[model samples]
Target: MSETYWDRHGIYGVMAEFEDPEQLVEAAKRTYAAGYRQMDAYSPMPIDGLAEAIGFTRNWVSLVVLIGGLTGCIGGFGLLYWIAEIAYPHNVGGRPFNSWPMWIPITFECTVLLAALSAVIGMLAMNKLPMPYHPVFNVPSFAERASVDRFFLCIEASDPKFDLEHTKAFLKELNPEEVAEVEK
Candidate 1:
């Protein structure tokens, strides 16, 4: 590809390396204050308040799970009702036409099963999981540093305020060891 193509679409973001969690958090705060959205931070371990500093508050996985559970519950109950009352209409030893008690176990199981699956699938989908490749992986410095006792903050090129030179200068001002441009 030509340099223009690389410049236009292949650059993912600019990343900076910090040695401490506090430094990373401060950098994220500064970057947020500088009006840069679409940023992310990675560290060897979770840092307290990092998500808040990065302006992440809402999560929707629980809502997905709730919807799944409700669907499962209603479907399970409806299936049992159709089987006993309408599909077969069996008179199993003078029992009630619709044995609500018998449906309890199956309904509970379905609810749990669907809720668990929803939690896992919704979380993975929301987080963009199963990601075998990413532009961040193209940054050689990130591969060695991000996972081994170093914290990295990346301000993505997709951010409205992202300018190659300006963002680079801003990251440099945060006193990172290196401010690297990540290729897609």
Candidate 2:
């Protein structure tokens, strides 16, 4: 194939191929301890402790969804309450205008709808999705085996401690199958 990216512009990082997820997790732990901040791991399956090993354990998507749901619930009820009790009072069947029971269904629906929507939208926003392209894709043959039976760890050059030769040596020290450069 054509030389992808790092060849033309600059190096993206170093990628190491491992036989299994355990090895990848160990390597990630070592890299993290070595002060490599910008790194990621890919495995055929969800590898437990991998995220923790890489030092990423915080997320706020749930909080965002909760806030969205509450806002939707209150807005839904308030809007109808304003319309029925304040804006234009419609006395139907001599029923009370401040009929909280009548507004339950719409408020519940709004809460569910906003919660679901916020979960999806907040997750996407938090994760910065829709990125159809990433430098890690240029790691040779990563596309084929990464989702099959292999695990890969990439230490990005953007990490402060990253020096191409040093990073390559570091990955090799992890006893991976092979350590290679990732093109941008």
Candidate 3:
């Protein structure tokens, strides 16, 4: 039998609780500087530069959305062209078969529809949604305070620099109110 990830680590990581968002941001920056890559922070509200401090530089969501929009635009225009000129060419009211003016509205509508749908699907896929469970939620206080008025920084055990005792000590040095182990 093989040891599972949960069994191997026996914990998710060490979490430090902070009362202020400033503390959370500073702690995250120090953790990142200490070479801890697999870490996350939570707060009641958005904190400017917090993500940058944690080394979150790039987001592929915009690229995904752009590709989706371009695809939609090209596909919509192509479909309209095929339908109007080849598939069902109708000589209605002496209008030309390749009348592009009338196809503009439907083509624009199709473009918007596909672009919107792709954006939604892309976002869901990128974020790995439908996650009904997470180890961070295992903490009793985290469940309630996470969305209210507290900030938290969790250093995952999976990080290369993570040593149970050493990481705990490191988090403690950050002067947090409390440091607790996160269970899997």
Candidate 4:
């Protein structure tokens, strides 16, 4: 196969749909046991134990926020320090050139502004947002019942252990109402 063929066909994984949330959770556990890593679960509402069943871990949003806040704090202080001490130093009303108190408001504002911007950008980048299309959206039934009553589990094509036959059989064993092979 050509590189493009592999790029298009290599990421073959099964999408299993379930009627009951509990069954979906159980199926997720079984899928995890079968060594599928690039899998996701969808539900009409949050289901307990689903995260553990699918081995989903907490995201790194907090770390991103912390780094952003720290950077903002440092940058704010540095900018104010440079302006007050080096750039156009002035002794207004006999106050010192390095006026720490006067710089507090600007420093605070800059810190908040940069931190908020970083948080918004970081979240978008981390989640891979702004995607124009997805293969899951191509599944006909997927659009009909995704938000109403059905639950879905999809194993992406990028997973290292993904095999068409094995994945189909694994999904079948989970007793899903329907198992569909998605193409991108």
Candidate 5:
């Protein structure tokens, strides 16, 4: 809840442009190794090792889906049990009230349904969707070439190790095509 560097300076970050995905990956790996955690890389297509280079680990969405699935499974089975044993208490063909075997289909469907919904919602929340604007788009070269042929690495101002001049010099050492400051 404290004031961030961006809040104080109106600067988003410093960005470096790379022409090749390999260069981007290498630069990202070096950056991450240099102890920079608040950084991101951009590329036109999926690069094989970029995620690993950026130090991306486990995500929380899977946990969310797992919990949602368990909730649905338990809730579905409980609903059926309540209907059969307590709510209606109906008997058919002299069968027992707790006919659990017949609940498998409904329970499975509910599990799948809730898991799928959780996946969608979790992904949206995790990715911060509905974002119509970002400071990265403010860079002309990035806006023109990010989805075309260029790759980018941006180290945000909010990073603990971020010092404007020092970070720029560090990025320069990576031999990027161009390095620019991103304004908020």
Candidate 6:
């Protein structure tokens, strides 16, 4: 038998589609109330209050940025200090050994460089980028409407409260145009 890649770590759950963005928001709220956690929502455009409805909390992007910036500042200062004090210290024109003003430019540049690099890397890591494959792509009819005029909500099988029959019935209650099973 051919090995099924998703057999072990697949999202086998029910999906709900909604016409009005408000309905989707309400549905998400109800889904959360019903103890569902591993679920996601899709819409043609941004929806107000939808994140709050689904109990979505802010990610750690800001924290990551702050830490990166601080680290960069410290690293830059440390590098410049080491270079000026120890490595080939040149007392040009009898200036002090620890020339604070002269080192500012390089320190500033290094700080900016490291902070920018960290922000980029942190964003990619937080969002789980470079994901080449996802099970949502397997939904044949789903692709057409996702980017167009429809909204979708999916509850994953891995959720603690996920039950095949119960989840399907709950989705049907949301009055989606169609409810379908998604694998992986």
- TM-score against truth, every candidate: 0.88, 0.89, 0.90, 0.80, 0.90, 0.82
lDDT ranking, high to low: 5, 1, 2, 3, 4, 6
Question: What lDDT is reached at residue 69 by model 3?
Answer: 73
Model 6: per-residue lDDT, tens digit, 40-86? 88888999988777778986777777777778778888888888788
Error of 6 at 39 (Å): 1.1
TM-score of candidate 2 against the unseen true structure: 0.89
- Candidate 5 Cα errors over 4 Å, as ranges: 4-6
All candidates: CA RMSD (Å): 3.2, 4.4, 2.6, 3.2, 1.8, 4.1
Model 1, range 16-105, lDDT digits (tens) per residue? 999899999999999999999789999988889999888998979889999989988998899999999999999989999898999999
State the C-alpha lDDT per candidate: 0.89, 0.87, 0.86, 0.81, 0.93, 0.80
Candidate 6 clashes between residue pairs 3 or more apart in a chain or in different chains: 11-184
Compare candidates 1 and 4 on lDDT and give the better one. 1
Judging by lDDT, tell me the better candidate of 5 and 6. 5
Error in Å for residue 155 of model 5: 0.4
Which stretches of model 1 miss by more than 4 angstroms?
1-9
In model 5, what lDDT does residue 92 have? 93
Error of 3 at 156 (Å): 0.6
How does model 4 fare in lDDT? 0.81
Candidate 5 whole-model C-alpha lDDT, 0 to 1: 0.93
